[model samples]
Target: MTVSGKTRHRFRCRYTSMPSPTSSLSSSYRNPGGSVSSSSLYHHASYLRRGKLVLGIMDFKWTLVFVITLLNLQPSSANGNGTVERKVHVGFIVDTQSWMGKIVDSCISMALSDLYLRNNHYRTKLVVHTRDFHGDPFLVLSQALSLLQSVELDALIVAESSGGVKILAGLGSRVKIPIISLFAAAPSLSFSQHPYWIRIGEDESSQAKGIATIVEEFRWRSVIFIYEDNDSAREFLPDLITSFEETDTRIALHIALLTSSTDGDIIDQLKKLMDLHTSVYVVHTSPILASRLFLNAKWLGMIGKEYAWITTSMITNFVNSMDPSVIEAMQGVVRFKPYVPSSKAVRRFEIRWSKNIDGNQNLQEIELNVCMVYGPMI
Candidate 1:
């Protein structure tokens, strides 16, 4: 009726060493009167007791009866009965060291947890494995390969803001694994080129219309455009130019700032723009570069009520995460951001996320697109 410590250890070893269910049941010994088997006793002894044992049924026959009753009480993976649960392994590759990457990782983790916790009938457990690329392209590829080969992930979720996503998407296609992107938004990485690639971020081209609308509403006939020299910005610039032309808004000057641009280089560009008579400007670049440009502009006294500064969604998406000084400099700047609906689920998620990254003072807001895209996919 009671299993000793040694007996319990022996039972565990035997149970673990046993072959598949398809094998013969000769290893199992059945009790007298066809009441219960040794296997059933082992199952009950393993789970029924807590820290201390209190067996009301001291007789072996009664113990066998209780074991049968408890075994039947176990939950089944299937809707009916006698089914095994399936497990899915998913990989996340992102720059966890960065602020935005940390936010994305947190959102993905919360999404996976919410999904499995709410859906009991799913019968599929999602195991998430994460790797930090540290914002390096080569590291991203290497880590991705390791996930594919070693981890054997069913799918991959990548959050990146660089040009390396094309290579990453290609690798996902080559391995026939779905690559869900929460950050990359270049139109060139469309579904046709890489069928395995799925983007949740808004396409850069789509924001061109919004920018044009803002320009037309303000009656700005001509405006200077400043953008980073990256694939997304370059691809977006042409579309924005076309949209401006359609709306009869001429782009008086277009400035492309390299990521490695020095302060002098930025100042030189700013000086040129300052000399121009056009007071309206449209800036499309990363949050870092945008902050730097605005800080320089503030020092030059260009960011004022007289100068109307309009930015695309790229800068607006990370406005809250920018430095206080940078935000102050661009106080009068106007931007159009994607709207996120208010819900109890979102509010709870926001509170949880805020606590997760509480130590990170740099990240003040969550990127809406990242949260939006993950909502439906998970």
Candidate 2:
């Protein structure tokens, strides 16, 4: 009852070396059957008056426990117990630094947001983990492997023309999950061969027919054909040839340029076509390369009233957003793309998409296969 500061210090030192301190805190200082309040962060002074001595310990330090709870105590991956929605993990690998990849990424995000907004009561959600390759096909393969190793993916999505479609599809087959391919124009994929691989778009056969039909309508006997020189492009040539043969239009000249062709390289190619008797030119390649070809053609005065320039859907989809000067360079150039109906939803998507990509002018409406973006979540 008369303990001084020195006496309190001695008692404190004696209690400091105990094997278990809970015993003294519960039994020696508290009420007869009362134990320490382990959950409460602080104890009231009234607890001491009633001889309860409610000692508050740091019971909130359960990071490991919370993690275990999230892993073991949560609901299944598909169904929730009326508390939280279950997650269906998805993996997306793309060249995000590229213009096309960035647009695809935006479309994927819009699809996911629209999906959950319409189905807020849905029990499952798709959680996407994205890896960017920045145009390197090898990086795409590595990223696919990394995602497969790190996540229990419900599905994995890749750009079909990204050059690793076969390897990624093989990975999906081994894991027994679906591999969704977007913008599939490479002509190498066969649905029958790879059961796990799902292609959202077709190769260039339909587009080729559309181009040939234009040639027939104009009564052009033959026209020059230009395409990117790559394995995929080479494989695509037979389709164009067959389509042109049907319309009795001959491919007078076929020129191939590397994907990395420069302004000088493109202008040189155009000059050759300009000197030719046939004035019609059908150019098919990736968007970037197509831009260079047409712009160079404009510079060489090959895109004027005398010459006819046509392009595939790949370039048309993003043509409206190209620098106005580039679009002007493409003046009188004809292109065929999947017709997208103008809806309020589509208009809003275009506006928001332009803002996201920081477009200087409005982008022309085009088709992105919604089925591919939405299927992974299901």
Quantify all predictions' global Cα lDDT against the true fold.
0.64, 0.59
Per-residue CA lDDT of candidate 2, range 1-378, in tens? 000121101000011112242232221222223332312101221121221111111122242243234334334543335565666677888777765676677778876777778878766566889988778777878898899889877777786475577677777778887777665535555656667776554435655655665556456788888889866667667878987888778999889999888899888888777778887777778877887777777777675546667776566666655666776677556655544345686677766665555642332333342322322222
* Tens digit of per-residue lDDT, candidate 1, span 1-378: 122121111101122123343443222322222332334433554442232211111133443353234334444455346666555567888887765676677677766777767876665566778889997867878888888888767778787757778888898789987786765356566678898876655545445655565456446678888999977688777778876877877999889999899889999999988788787888888888998999999899886545767677677767777777887787656565544445696677677777766777666454444344353344
**Cα lDDT for residue 246, candidate 2:** 81
- Residue pairs clashing, model 1: none
Clashes of 2: 0
In angstroms, the error of model 1 at 59 is 62
RMSD of each: 27.0, 31.5
Candidate 2 local Cα displacement, residue 280, angstroms: 1.2
Q: Which runs of model 2 end up more than 4 angstroms from their true locations?
A: 1-84, 354-378
Model 2 C-alpha lDDT versus the unseen true structure: 0.59
Poorly placed runs, candidate 1 (over 4 Å): 1-83, 364-376
TM-score of 1: 0.73
lDDT of 1 at 370: 34
